[model samples]
Target: MTRFLHDQFAKDYLEELLTPYGTIQSSRPVSSEVREVDLWFSPHPESTLSPDSLGLLARAIQTPAIFEPFRNPATTREIRDCLLKLLEIDAELRRESNRQVSLAPDTSPPHLWILTPTASRTLLGGFGATLDLESWPRGVYFLPPQLRTIIVAIHQLPRTPETLWLRVLGRGRVQTQAIEELEALSPDNPWRANALILLNRLKAHLERNLNPDWEDRQLIMRLSPLFDQQLEAAQLSGLQQGLQQGLQQGLQQGLQQGLQQGLQQGETLVIENLLRFRFGEVDEELAQIIQAILRLPASEFTPLLMQLSREELIERFREE
Candidate 1:
């Protein structure tokens, strides 16, 4: 229904990172035109710290704000549209407080943060956006003070862990590099797990829809190894734990679960990843083929999945 999986991923990623420090509402209605803001965040009154993983991204926002993330470079029309939504929101807030816009506190109305992968110099100059290079970074461009808006060009941001949280929302190599850093983080980090799950889903979507974009293809390739590595790591942990507990207890029960099903599930996960990696999400038609794969010996079907075409896979497993 949405244009692509990346749109949803961007919103989910921002919501998760901001959830710890604020109240966030995604796809919130704003104007009479029925425009929906991507994210509306109101910071908590007592909170001072956001998740350390977010780094500089957290430091950028210290007040209530609206965050609109674009998977593509935002155009002038899109910028004006975003401004209109911001105006409507500001009006609504002023009405709710029953206060004059001029009389209320400077931040009574939330600021609009438009985050695009890139913004051209022409667009920035046309809108009269100035970079606060002293306080903020290079990619951040501010409108005149009263307009209350900023454009964040992720690609133009500095390459550092401080910007990695924002960079993960970028395209192609930027996102891949950020994901690599995320993978290097402790496996116990919940943010990494959430991001990886979304990335896996993103890969599946790209695979299923027959994405012609080179960028999507590159992303899928980059994510494939991450999925494989994590699967192997999880399988090893399962095996080691099972063997240790089995040695202390009845060997039969331990072997039955840890050794047998652990390997099966681990292999199954890989097979599932490979299937999705190869063919996309399992449709009702494809699900039957996967069930058949589950029934077969792991070695037999695992190799087959790697080698079979979609049509060949359907013909091979449809009857089973």
Candidate 2:
């Protein structure tokens, strides 16, 4: 199966966000082999990798590479191999750094994280076991709880223009204080306004194409303004179609009812003519029977005519 485009989009999105924090790598071949990693993040040389960074890495690593239907196995295998190599490298790094060099006990190991969107129960089970899980360095860990929680929250939000805006702002560990700083700016803060506009556009693209089914309340509340226009357009289109269909059906039914009534009247006149010719005069009894005959549909009139002879019709129409 071809890998799902959403999976690729998610990977790209996370990579872009995480790049500033650390070195981000994707689909790199492990060693000289055909195997490749989905994503890999290493700490910046100047900064000591914190638990938060490991948390972010974990989120990236755990993000699922959704399988694309009809995708080439070679592609999948290559991706799997790259991920395995990344893990191997992480293990090797830990072994070398922790064992060979005497680093401080408090210093964390270099982390390696993976991303999978729809991880199967079997794959998760495998990770729980020794094949892939054992390669991590001691201090280096996957995405920490906080980062995972944030990612999960973002994932749950509805894929709408508004939700996407909130997501960009909500991602990672930006300070609440910084947000307050932005809020404190006057209406003329061109820089902040421009940033908001760009962010909103990015969110619109993500919502429109990537996660179109997201529906989290938190995300919805934050981004409501951007999505209202699209939502209204869709609703109006649907309403117009419904009204048109309803009007057509009503017109058809009204025409059918009028045609049926006209047919009944014409049939009554035909039955009166047949009675007057056969009996020489129209009587009260014959008139009632003719009325009934006129009301009878054409299909019923044929069967009644087949069963009745001239003599029987005259006798039945004779006054008591």
Candidate 3:
């Protein structure tokens, strides 16, 4: 169950970060064996966000690519399964191109990225994976050229901003350290907001399990402060906006009435922000429940916002 949770997080994290630069298809189906590729990404010619901003992760996705992230160290069999998926995709692409005008003589096969927390030297050696450190970074190993596959040993990656995105997919100490780095990035950093939101979602999922392991408990503790900081920030924003609006009304009405109005609006705005962060958007169904949601204290309502599904939340808070 925990493994599936991590897999979902990886897919969500990668899709969020890469969406601006390319087309991202999660759980892409392969024609044979009903195997699914974890992620299939093809870069856009005129992307809104610069690929350079993502550093090494951007480099990996410059071409058509497949991403397979493992929560634990990948065994040999797992690695082969990833390869087979890639080959299946390549064949599928080839057959489709046959029906269209050939653009560049042939379609290039997508590069396969196998990401794992750790990879032993023997494990790499057994697959004949070699490091081209002169061309790439320390932790990345490539199989033979024809294979077009790269195995990233996350634990071996240098602790730097360039590797931060990929490192977030790692486990244990590697993941903990990566998140710490992620938290410290400037608020203006484009990736920071979405990454934190996804991490918070992951935290909520992990917490739902009654018996999380020690590492997950520590992770939950670390993530709690970040959530608080975001909530506080949201409240501050709401208050400022409310006060600005209230002051305009104060000129026509009593100062006390305006201040009371400001407080109410402020709380409402805060709840709206929380809902948006949790569920992407607030539709008419959710809008109907904002007043009901605002009636509860932050401590009481915040968990409901985190743990409940869209339908569940609406059903729980829908106006009578």
Candidate 4:
């Protein structure tokens, strides 16, 4: 489940990164016969379409398709076919003359980018091997230089707490370089906030694991707000269930013991009553002793009852 969320996050991150450069379209249908492209990006000005434009297109297309139980195979095939068609379209567009002058024909072909989280070994083999990186029908080329940079950037993105902290601590050595590059392209960037948040989360994890003495009473906070709440509620529910089970078992055991004691006492009272009826009266002291004997094992209590005279028996049978 968490993996699914992470994959979605990656897709969204890629989308956000590309949104600034062009008109971003997602699940866009290329033709009536084909499925929609996962994402399609086009330059606003037709004249601006160049290697850089193709590079941006490549980046947009490289985002992985998330598959689930209900994923449609036909839709997947349609999307693939649509992308192939779009690549051809991009090639034709690039070849057209901007002005009346017929310039030398741009002979480069467009590249098709496919992204998936877990590509099969076979698919990866096809990526750099059988899947031609150079020539295609469209003027767009695969493995554009700018798109390669973006791929490197994606690889360098912090995916875990440890990596986040490492990037922060090595800010001078590592992130500074990337920051400078990004700033050169877009001076006022919003990605800084996201980068900082990732750093903070990494710091928090470090504080919890490494600095036992540094207690910020509020610092033992939940990593995920929703999951943490649910975890706490689940623990409390389990504890309640355990306590109830223990109490029920205790009550059942106590009731069984109590019933046994009551039955023994009742039998002793019957014996005492019989002696009182036969011998006229029972002594108070003897009756108290006989009552105490009710708690003895039935074998012991029965043997003690046989060795008494009528008057002795009457005295032994007396009630308190």
> Judged by lDDT, which candidate is best?
3
Is 2 or 4 the stronger prediction by lDDT? 2
Better of 3 and 4 by TM-score: 3
Candidate 2 lDDT (Cα, 0 to 1): 0.40
lDDT by residue (226-280, candidate 2, tens digit) is 3343233333443454445444555677866545544444455455544443334
Report lDDT per candidate: 0.75, 0.40, 0.84, 0.37
Off by over 4 Å in 1: 1-3, 50-52, 99-108, 188-190, 251-320
lDDT of 1 at 114: 92
* Ranked by TM-score, top first: 3, 1, 2, 4
lDDT of 3: 0.84
TM-score winner: 3
| Clash count per candidate | 0, 33, 0, 9
Q: Candidate 3, residues 213-283: lDDT per residue as tens digits?
A: 98889989988998878767766676677677776687578888878887777678777877786666888
lDDT of 4 by residue, 156-214 (tens): 33433222311222222243444334323332334433332232333333344543332
RMSD of 1: 7.6
Residue 80 local lDDT, model 3 = 94
TM-score of each: 0.74, 0.31, 0.90, 0.29
